[model samples]
Target: MLQPRDELPSVLYSAAQVRDLDARLIAAGTAGFELMQRAAQAAWRALRRRWPQSTRVDVLAGSGNNAGDGYLLAALAQKAGWTVRVLAVGDPQRLAGDARLAFEAAQAAGVAVLPWAARTSLQGVLVDALLGTGLSGEVHSPYREAIEAINASRLPVLALDVPSGLCADSGRVLGCAVRAELTVTFIGLKLGLFSGDGPTLVGDLVFDDLRADPAILAGVPVKARRLTAAGLQALPPRQRDAHKGDFGRLLVIGGDSGTGGAALLAAQSALRCGAGLVSAATREVHVGAFLARCPELMVRGLASANQVLPLVEAADVLVVGPGLGQSAWGRSLLSVAASRSDKRQVWDADALNLLAAGVVQAPAGLVLTPHPGEAARLLGCSGAQVQADRPQAALSLAQKFAACVVLKGAGSLIATPEGELALCDHGHPAMAGAGLGDVLAGIIGALLAQGMSAQAAAHLAVWLHARAGERLGSQGRGIAASDLIAPVRELLEEHSPCLD
Candidate 1:
């Protein structure tokens, strides 16, 4: 289950920004050591709550302030009469200032401080304080080995701040990061904790401001805003005298030979999400199937690019490229769709591919939904490169195309050309299926047609799609693309009811 949004701040920060926030607090008269003590206390309370019956804790310590936190936590456990040991992975002698003081306090409190070795026995619930947010380069030497050991232990682990070996800035694992089951982070929430490998490595997260002044925290710049169900901008309640034409017309353009289901899914999703009129333009062979499945959509079979011109002109919003194969038939339809600068469009799948290939240029008022591979192609980089810095990649795409870009993956990032960014971390692994992107494209299109701005539509659509998938995903895998539409519609009503 996802953590409650009320417990977390909406704003997300970079590692550097968090450090600045810490510095600001210290400058305001709160001692640095006091903040460290608060972090330890917060972590201890969370640990005890999670494992009330467990009494033993092994602290994996480094040489940084992160190690100090571990030492203080060890002291707390020792005073509580629980078996506690601090395995000093990073040489304890190198520790200085507050870290040294923390170590001395632990030793004075009768906490066992032992040098870490290859054959060190890892027992009970482990506390990972091996590395902090300052980590940049790939982890090397004993630290990597220690992180490996922690993962191998398979015991319930609690990571202080960011997980060891995980990039607090990018969420990329440096060599191998500690996979903690519970992570208690301090001060500002890091962006890496929500994107890339951060979500998978850092398990159930707990955030504490460490009692920093709210005005001080607000002064520092944030990387992005986290999109929560409660925080999303809702579509206004429909009028009692509303008619079908009250909402704008949305056209779904895609569905090549042997790939009709993709366009149908988008069209169906739009209809379910309250688009006034939804139309689908696909291959002639698939027209009958689309109409049979969803007769509400004005399904038209296209034979050439010219056939789509009229449909493109009529649509207030267009959803392009779902199962839109990289073929002549698909290319012709996308070309026509791209020509409509007046129409707000959600481009996904092969539409992104075509854009990357320079087959056509997308107009303004566009939402480009690209998975990592597609984003890589669009940016002329590898998929690994795109995943390494998802936030930057999303921003780059939005700026390059002057469009709203949804860099979809683990933590789907939504970026606007104006540099506004938002993240949706509400999806489940079970959402890994075909046609999900198509459904998302439709959802965005419907929201856009219903008078939401390009960025607002993309944000609301991504949140709704992911939340719907998360709900259905709980029933286990094998979720079809169509499975999300009803749930999305239901969730939309709950979020923005037809009647106030």
Candidate 2:
């Protein structure tokens, strides 16, 4: 539910990638310590801008280059006539090279350097440089206590680079992580800063490239890209003489009994998103309700799987599994839909559950949208494990099924079988409601029906859905799945006008 900010770089690097980039920058004539000084300078300027009234600074320093940045910041603060304190969580004696030089600089500036203890009192705008992107294991010892104490203090904090104990690659917290009010990141933007627990804990994020040579950066492989307006491919402008048949037919299959609402949301979303022909195939029990709710839909009620074949045959894209119960009725329709391998498909809800249960093989030309739990079931692992490294889990699922996978939640991620990955950091907390997935599936199906490839459709749909939720979420709670349709339609038109 974090707010979306101005556009950042599309490419996101792993911690290893950032480290390599740093090394290359140093080897390419930028001294390592000089880069460290620039990082401190960037952080100092950001801190001053964010809290100009606060004149005191407390820097929690650890060993390694992370601490080097902290020590340098403490030096800068002291020189600026601010009361500065450096709580050394890791032994400063262990510091070497640039880190040692930074510590000496801090001492020369008369910054109060103290060995951290459980009872140490923190003041002013706290700086978390105790741990950086290199931390992959659980936080241990004094660092864990230090992080806990920082969180307990509830003081405004500015974290240098990645927050202490936050996995820079996955956005997962290692045991405990510092909750900073502002984070100043150096070099390339880390994928973790926008995904998982990152948005919640990192607070306001500010990125500085540290003036790394663009050519040196281009040589490093990017792990993923953030979804942005400029990067989105718009739907082709409608011709002066247009017909509904010009788009594509999209069939929404689901809504067993009491869950007909879910399927209705999907159908409604597709209709709003400009599908040529939108149809809903559900149990006979829900047919009247579906038609009543969305009169534009071509609604058909069925008692068995035999009734779905004709609809599946006509659809250019199929959105399956919204409100699809695990009963025989749901399975029968899913089986029939699964058989239509040539039709582009978007599978969600029970469809994903059924696929995980081995009841139906995934179809060709497919997009699977699953939340963390559903993704875990699809990958044969626990939800926690999947969430631990969402990027890898998403990639694994895509490779296993040879389909485009949209792993939805906090920072929704889209991955393809070819190992391409993209992340969407646009959304709001009010979006935490039921039937949203169904709406999302329909949006994707509508995009596919409009002739977009699965990857492109997913990227656009995910971004649009999240952005719509974000806009509506600003009004505060009570956001229904149906509520997102109009906004989504409006957003689509804005992104791609009908005439031009």
Model 1, CA-based lDDT: 0.92
* Model 2 alpha-carbon miss at residue 65, Å: 0.4
Cα-based lDDT for every prediction: 0.92, 0.93
Off by over 4 Å in 1: 1-6
**Candidate 2: tens digits of C-alpha lDDT, residues 388-492:** 899999999999999999999999999999999999999999999998999999999999999999999999999999999999999999998899999999999
What is the clash count for each candidate, in the order shown?
0, 2
**Top-lDDT candidate index:** 2
Model 2 alpha-carbon drift over 4 Å, by segment: 1-4
TM-score of each: 0.98, 0.98
Candidate 1 pairs with clashing backbones: none
Candidate 1 at 474: error in angstroms? 1.2
